[model samples]
Target: MRKKYLFIGLFIFAILFTFGCTSGNNPKDSFQKYVDAWEKQDYKTMYTFLSPSSKKSISEKDFIAKYTNIYNGIEVNKISVAPDYPKSFKKDSDGNTSIPFKVTMSTVAGNIKFNDTAYFSNNTKDSSNPWSLNWNIKMIYPDLNTDDKIRIDKTFGKRGEIKDANGSYLAQNSYIESVGIVPEKLGADAENSKKQIADILKIDKGVIDKALSASYVLPDMFIQIDNLSMDDTDRLSSLAKIPGVMLKKTPARVYPLKEKAALLTGYVQPISADELKKLSSQGYSKDDSIGKSGLEKIYEKQLKATDGAEIYITDKEGKKLKTIVKKTEQNGKDINLTIDSNIQSALYDQYKVDSGTAVAMNPKTGAVLALVSAPGYDPNDFVLGMSKDKWNSLQNDPNKPLLNRFQATFAPGSSFKPITAAIGLKTGKLDPNADKNISGLKWQKDSSWGNYYVTRDAAYNSPANLLNALVYSDNIYFAKTALDIGKDNFINETKKFGIGKTLPFEYGLDASKISPDNSIKDDIGLADSGYGQGQVLMNPVQLVSIYTSFVNNGNIIAPYLNAAKGTPGKILESNVFSQDISNTILNDLTQVVSNPAGTGYGAYMPNLPLAGKTGTAEIKKSQTDTTGTENGWFIATNTNNPKLLVLEMYENVKNKGGSHYVVPNVKSIFEQFCK
Candidate 1:
């Protein structure tokens, strides 16, 4: 009986010993679990693996603080942990095992690679003596002591220049001197400095006084006075002599073309707080500049540069001990636009009217040569930070200088006659060669078509065919043609031309509406729309696109601004009109400019054979203005080289003589390019 009891006791003791040895020998498994926790930022789970002595030295809260505060400051984006030496754990004579590890951390600053060791030992609290990690700050980052920290420094890349087709600078960075006053540094001369600055810049004295009266004015801080031009170096030298005045040169976005190409080039401004929050993950900082409109806003991602960064290991005193990672910033790629600088300048000069828009494109390839919106404001104003008063003045201007007229809609008037003529021919509703006994003065569907009457000039009183009607721009002729085509076919044919749809353009465009919801309402309404009236609105860009079909033998190609030599034009519609039909329409349009009695005869070039149309749209009086106005429009193409198409529209020509107001400008633009 004694021998049996002794045997059972020895057997149980042997089993307990076996379990303790197995748990203590598996240090690699314990180290792997701890590494997994660290990678996930689960400090609590990591802390559970710490040996009894390690936990006593550093609490879980302190362990988490090390990762969240110090590590996060470096902008760590990713962390990867792997065995540094061998997969097996190394045992020391002290009954402890060490698992070597290689940690690579990817951060905004750069990649930081380092070696660390996680020590494991049998826990004193466990009777089984299970292996546990002897954790410490050193296990995460090598040589990371309580008084040491990680520091990161960022360097922004330089913005690229915007150049025209000829490589002339449109938008570029320039150095300007910012003059300001340091009030506290002025001592007894604060009042004198303010007066001197105001006098030198010819600015109001109250402006300087208000700037100095700020509650948070600091002695060493700068209070901006003005941004001095580079040409104002002499003035800057004189201003710097003021007691408390300081002048610092800083880089600024500048439009070398100024107001000439302002509408197309656009401008940039400091990013708002909301923008920063949304773009934070893209590495956008508070001080970054962002594009606000036009081409600048459209290609922001391509124009934006890649930011570089540097990471430093530093002591508590803020002295950088060594740089862990360094990266060089890559400058942004320069953008080359398709606009011809000379043609653009000529177009702007010829648009002498106060408010209007014009667009010229290659009819064959659809490459836009020039685009202009009159009453343009200098983009430099926005870039240099426009004052509240100046901004309000521009916003309130009657001409709407900030509006991009090229994208804004206008009643096409008789300029839309060609489209109406096309619809009539396509639907077999009108005979191009046969003469119609249409009234020149007035016409209506019938007596029951209400009191609505389509009136025309008495000059069109003679028997008229398609050719003669187009030359005279007889409103009655086109209106009669639209009614004959019927409402459903008219709407469907117009839709085929992409009317009432938003044009696909890189620079945004407002959709042209035939009429809201394509509704013609009644026979009179349909007739009114025939001559580009009754809710029919078209933008200059789309108008040029529609005209290109006549030039390209009735194959409509959507106009594009940024086409290279071999880039094929996108075909919007095929077989819009047969070759014979397109030729007949082209011949009739040519007579409008070539014929002596044609309305567009004034737009004829001396040597260039021009083909085009003219229009005059009436505007109704509105609450904003008591006087109604007329919008003059003209579109033409060179008869020899049909690829060159020009479109011009003049606004608010109340008493102006019909389409005659736009003829000279259109002629001048063609002369510049064709001659």
Candidate 2:
């Protein structure tokens, strides 16, 4: 009987111990779990922790959706949730627990931080958890309440302006009219009216039909067909009498320089769908404008507008209650270029009729003043909206009006002689005063060259010396000079002038090539390359930069576009040639222009002291091919001030006096700037 009594006592003690443990539940621990789920953006887990009364107020799906939509709309990220609570659990007089918490996150508008209290019910009845959150809209946002809505408001900033060195507009914000048609107002002759519209707008009739046939279009709704610049829309005044034609003025990007600066400034258009998807996180929308080409595209970060945002609480009446986040809109920074508008216009006016490209730069400062690619299409057409027919015409034009020739490379022709001469002098292979015993207008290194031979202008059959060779543009002299320098030495020396390397400039320029794969195959190939023929191609800007070494005491100046980044006299390759060699070459090039017998004599002008070289690069399948074309090249600058260095190239100058065809044209531009 005593043993049974002892067993009963021990069992009762064990039961009491289990009951004590179950009653030791802390509300702070439950609150911590809810805060953790909030930080992870786990709305479902947070919903499961809500009190029965809170759950009855909002459905689980609606709760999760509300958090998601609001967070995404405001671009919320980097979420943090911290709760301020005591070490021990305590209950208020009403049998509830309240814990203060802080919420922080990054948004497009800016950072958001707020503090609020989380209330939990102390009653554990009919629930597995000892604590349940008494959730409400205030728990999501401190300023939010029932029947209140969270809203995001956007304000767009103005796009920046592109200006010349004189602060003249190259590209700027302006106005245009959106031309459209309303089908309901069109008379019985709707097809005829569309034909007339197509003719006026230079568009296809099918384009109008497709736009009107859209599923979203209504008979009275305005169906936009094309846009026209405000300054150029006078031609459309006759369309006002038409039944359905309408013009709505809208903001647009305008190019004042038109075709003259088209390739330099490029143009802007509405952002594409793919671009929007990629840039959504950057606060970019489908309605935003994006740069398409040229400087506009390259400097997009500095020229694009920054949108401002405001996240606020609104009532059912659509009245704003409180602002949770605010960001000020910032306009894009204006870009000032080193381009001189006067020089840019002068070069374009001179080269507009030819199939060629011209570049004028301040050789000493490395400031690229003018870049003109002739047969240019107006950039304003792109901004005003181009029609299918107009676009096709530009694409089909034999002259290739759309090509940015300045960005392309071509054979330097005789223009590359200076480089070869410098290399020859640097390698100590050629004596400037010593005359080479080369004869005839055409010569080759023995019969190993077979039928292939280097030909020179018949006008220059004088004794072959360094000065006379450069002045006469004697191909055989330079070819013989290259043979003396050898292949390995020539290529290694050429690389010092930035060949086979990327140019450090804002504009994209093709790297100047030395030879096929940077290697000369044989003596014939080396001879041809020495005169800038065999795979010796260079962009106009790079050619101008290399020429700068002659005036910069044998140092190549790095060419620059944006005025802000241009450091005057910034050396690209230091000491490419010794001071004595540079001076000698400069004097020889000067004589080529001033002397009547010189090949570059066409460019000679009195009192201007111009120095330059002329080149004619032949394009043919073989050396003996009679049906071949020639590209004319001219590099000229004032030897005194050494300020403006110009390079001009014209295609298909065969039987047109070769490189001399562009020499006079280059001289006229210098007259406008200097004389």
Candidate 3:
């Protein structure tokens, strides 16, 4: 009996010892070894721990390159690991091992400190039931300890939707399917067929060849192909079956009415090498495309979206064995706009091929009705990696095709009369009923015209109310008005109306439009200011704003870019002033079109009480060619609802163009839309 008891005990001890030995060699131990290997830069050992599929899909060279790039970006602070990893198991549910992780990172965000908030989690399904893990590997935001993530987590977070006032889609996101080629499978003769493919795709032959030849790229990848136009897509995909191509699925940025608001919506240009360096400084990778310009740049944070990823193990034969790790990608915010896309389309058509800009606004609320910038390019041109030729064409075009001229600064010509009139009225220089005579001024230094042109004009011209000055667009009348208002007072008043200043609206540049010249021609320049000419500069919206102040009875509301309240980086900084214009000035303007003898009577809205000013500017010439010389402008507001403010102008037009030509178009637009 004693011998049997001893044998049983020995047998039990042996079984316990065997169990301990097997557990010691389990996946958990292998995962720990992998972590240590990574810390020591034993890349070869780490490579051994990677799943077989990962090894095949990505080589050690690729892995090293990715690691190096991430390390360089994260060297600012190397995160330290905890003494014990929290509830961590090195193995996944299927007894498959995981990549090792053991620490948390923290940062200051606004008022809160987020600790490992950018968590990388994987819920990998395995063949084995009741599978659980210790700690999973994470590629947290800018963490030095982990690799840079490869996925943009769409399921994790999403951006808001962008739409127009009538619920028209200005910009939106949709799932897309794409294609790629296996470079290694490409035959040597494949290079010879490049021209044939290029011809088929209607793209430059050199571009196709270059894309095919780049290393670390799919041989014939459709990295970015247009998701629209099924006719061409069907044709192209059939041609790509030439030897070594494969199909891929992905999501792409699609702007449906891409041509309608090309400049206003902006384009997405690819990053140059310099841009990559800049982005790296900001903790972003080359793969990312943030906003470049237009509403895109102005609201990048809200529009930026990311896709998430998961890392997993694969068997020796190349089957996915386990999900080593995972993290989801986040999407950018949605944007909504105040733009009436239909009106925008209508305005674009009005330009036809003319190089001009048109902008309409709601005088009561300052909502933009339509915005058009001519010599435009399709925003789609930049979407799928802009070619050098197309990009250069846009960049070198003298017309400035990319500029949103609705917010561009140009000499207002006579169109600025109303703004000057407002300045005159607000500064108490001239009453609406006070007629100021135009008199000639002597030059401080005598030139071709001698001391003076002796241009005799009237002050208190009984017929010369503010409306009369605007009607005749009398240059000398406004000249006296400007001098009466004085330079300092005039500048201040213009600035208040958002002239000579960056508008709170996003469509303008940093520099204000005030021209700098300090001479008597400049005084005559002030004369021109009365009629929207001389040193005075303003954009389309400024006309809208100034006219609003006039027609809205001295109330000035700042312009609105988007009607949606939650655009990512866009915040409306509009201003509204409560000042009042006299009943007298409003009456004179109202009668400008109603009165038959008035210059602007031809511009009357048939059924509505309307007031407007016309400006014809002699574009200062440095050349003998009078072709495309000056600008023609007209501005108007509907008195009944004051709901619409329209400004239209044409440049370098035929028939020695002036404000008359544009008045018809403005009247047409106002007549058609205001109702």
Reference-based lDDT, residue 377, model 1: 90
Ten contiguous residues minimizing lDDT sum, candidate 2: 18-27
Q: Which candidate is the best by lDDT?
A: 2
Residue 274, model 1: lDDT of 93
Runs of candidate 2 exceeding 4 Å displacement: 1-152, 181-196, 209-223, 386-398, 459-461
Ranking by TM-score: 2, 1, 3
Question: Which numbered prediction scores highest in TM-score against the true structure?
Answer: 2
Residue by residue across 222-323, what tens digits does model 3's lDDT show? 443223332246755765666555545444455667666877777554456677655544433445665677777777667765534444334345456444
Over 4 Å off, model 3: 1-160, 175-196, 204-250, 269-286, 312-326, 434-462, 506-525, 566-582, 595-602, 621-628, 654-656
State candidate 2's TM-score.
0.80
**Residue 27 deviation, candidate 3, in Å?**
30
Judged by whole-model lDDT over C-alpha atoms, candidate 2 comes out at: 0.87
Give the C-alpha miss distance for residue 136 in model 2, angstroms.
8.5
Give the worst 10-residue stretch by lDDT in candidate 1: 560-569
- Backbone clashes (count) for model 3: 45
> Residue-pair clashes per candidate, as listed?
1, 0, 45
Give the per-residue Cα lDDT of candidate 2 at 643.
90
For model 2, residues 1-675, the per-residue Cα lDDT tens digits are 999999999999899886655444656767878878888889899898888889999999999999999988887755888888866557788777778888888777887999998888865574477678888998878888888999999887889999998999999988888899999988898888888888888778998999999999989899989887777645578676677899898888999888898888988988887887677667675568989998889988899998788999999998999999899898998999999999998888876567889999999999999998887878888877776778899999999988999998999898999999999988899899888977787898999778888888764556679889888888988998999999999999999998988789889988889864888989988999888998788989999999999998899999998999789889999998899889989999999999998888988888898889999999988888889899999999999888999999999999888888889889898888876
> What are the candidates' C-alpha RMSDs?
7.3, 6.2, 13.5
